[model samples]
Target: MRRLLNDLKIMLLANFWLIPVIALLVGALFYFVAPPPPMHAKMATGAATGGYHAFAERLRDELAKEGFTLELVESRGSLDNLGKLLAGDVGLALVQSGQELTLSERQRGDLFGLGVMYREPVWLFVRTPVTFQRLSDLADLRLAIGSDGSGTQAVIGALLAANRIEEGAYPENWQRIGGSRAANALIAGELDAAFFLGPAENALIQRLAAEPELRLESLNRTRAYLARLPYLSAMEVGEGMLNMPMDTPAKDIVTLGPVATLVANEDFHSSLTPLILEAARKVLENGSLLDPPDSYPAAPPRSLQTLDEAEYYYNKGLPILQRYLPFRIASLADRYIILAIPLLVLLFPLFKAIGPLYQWRIRARIYRWYKHLREIDLQLYKGEWPDDLDAEIERLEQLESEMGRIEVPLSYSNELYQLHVHLRYMIERLRTAQKRRQA
Candidate 1:
């Protein structure tokens, strides 16, 4: 055991040069690897009570679990959210699917889609006892299309345009007020009907659904609208889908509307794509009335180009490391993995050289003694002998004893023994010369 310990000590001393070399390589790895993704980001959402804002709040909570802070920026609606992304005010935003049609070609180039979060159905609620067979039938009555610069207004304008009802030809009875104000007006008998855009599970939508005097109307021309407006999807709302107790719709309803899509700008980090999307997926795991379970955070009906990372996430779930590790740690591991191949290539040759280098170092300790032996043999060959021949012989014997205490691994024992033989031969030659001088 003691010999084993001594051998280990010698081996460690021999390879001390590797310490600095390994440190240098590790430093290079850190210098070249990209920094970890940002731990915080800004998101643009709609009014405080709106569905976009509500979804953003849920997303913020989910990301917080992974130690990521999500700052939510309040805006008017989808158009406002889109504007924020274009102005570079926020890294990400929730936008209605068709709102991109309002963007110019240049503006469109600045944005990219992550995925759709959920469906935003177009709900048209009118005062009861005033039934309309078609949208044109209620043209003469008081109407609140939607607020200015809101997604509701955008969708309403498209619907009117498809029906050939140009804005210039709009009736004087049509109003631009929307949201709680519109719902209030329709309840107070001030307006005949109002258009709202949001998920059926939205608080505002649920409130309006439970209203006794207001009636939720279906878009009978859904097929025609979908054909003309490709971005709109046909949604089937079964009886009592919104509220099982109140039986909100009273019967089956078919509506055509746009989806709420998660959009990102060029400034948003691509590496954060999977993290955000996965959080969103978790948020919508239990689908709403119109959306099936695990049906959302899907990859279509986007106006701008889809992010490559987002596409990868949709095709295959979260990256392997991200699934098991915390997001920050996982992201770090991911970056290291990208550079691992080159790092390994560099270390391979370095590690391979250790064996040969160590061998040279151990052999050097035994070879240095040969210098003293060579000097003695040269003096005798020149016929020049020392006066204290016996004392010289005694010193050589002491050297041989000292050499026995030096140790090398078993594999190099042959070299050590050969060293012993050479030392003995030199001592014998010195003794012979001393005896010849005495005779």
Candidate 2:
């Protein structure tokens, strides 16, 4: 151990600059290859009672169980959620599907989805029976199209515009009250029709579905809607799906809806993706409204593209390392696992070459004294040995003393011993020559 350390000391002293340079290189590697995982993250959710908000709370609680804190910031709706994510107010948010496709290249580059958490069916409730087969029939009636910035308003607005209803043929017909309020207004004879974009579990949605006077519109133009709005899909609610006991709806109701996707800033912490996704699985997998069991958390959401992690997760599922280890450690391992390959390539050669280089350095020191010894031996053989015999003896004695104090690693001790033997032999030859000259 001591000998090995001595060799390392000598090698490093001879090439001391490498220490800091390598340290700097390692630091840069860690900086680029192994960023620390975020301890906490914030998500921009919707109104307190909205589906997005509820999903966020469940996610927060799930993450908290694993010692991670997820803060939920309430916003108006999907539009507001998108705004917060872009402005960097939060790391993630629940956005209505399809809105992300409207962003510019720069905006798209800044955002990505984890996956579609669940489908949010766009529901149209009418007090009267489906007298009209189209959305145009409800134009003259008093309607609530949800809050101004809500996904319900955005989708309904598009449908209204396509049907030429937004051309101001009926200016006083619509109101901007949100889901719970709209449900109440419809029951009180204030609203003839209303739209809500959420799961059936919402109290307002549940009550509206159970209302005897009100009827749910199937939006018979669902195919045409999907043709124009690729983000939405045709959805069907089964007869007993809402309330099995009440057999709410009494029949299947076809509708149009955009699924709700869990989106995040592109720079959001990579480690949290799978963790939140797994948590989403627990909450959204039971399905909602129109979805069947295990129907949600779909990869490559219909509207926006997803992070590559989501692609990997969907295709391959969670990493094996994450399955065996804690999330933080596993994430760190995954981050640097690629880095570890290159680092190993770098360090293996350096470590393999070190011992030889160190030995060469040790040999160089011994070679210096050997060079002087060679010159002295040649001089002693060529001339009358007694002329500078005393001086030569003194020179040999000094060489021996100097060599005694010299150090090398124990592995090279054999070479050092050979050097001592040569010195002693030279001294003896010099004395023999002196005696012969005197005789």
Highest lDDT: which candidate?
1
TM-score of each: 0.86, 0.86
lDDT of 2 by residue, 59-78 (tens): 88888877789999999998
Evaluated against the true structure, the overall lDDT of model 1 is 0.89
- In candidate 2, residue 103 scores what lDDT? 76
**Which residue runs of candidate 1 sit more than 4 Å off their true CA positions?**
243-247, 371-407, 410-413, 424-439
Q: Per-residue error at 109 for model 1, in Å?
A: 3.6
RMSD in order of candidates: 3.4, 3.5
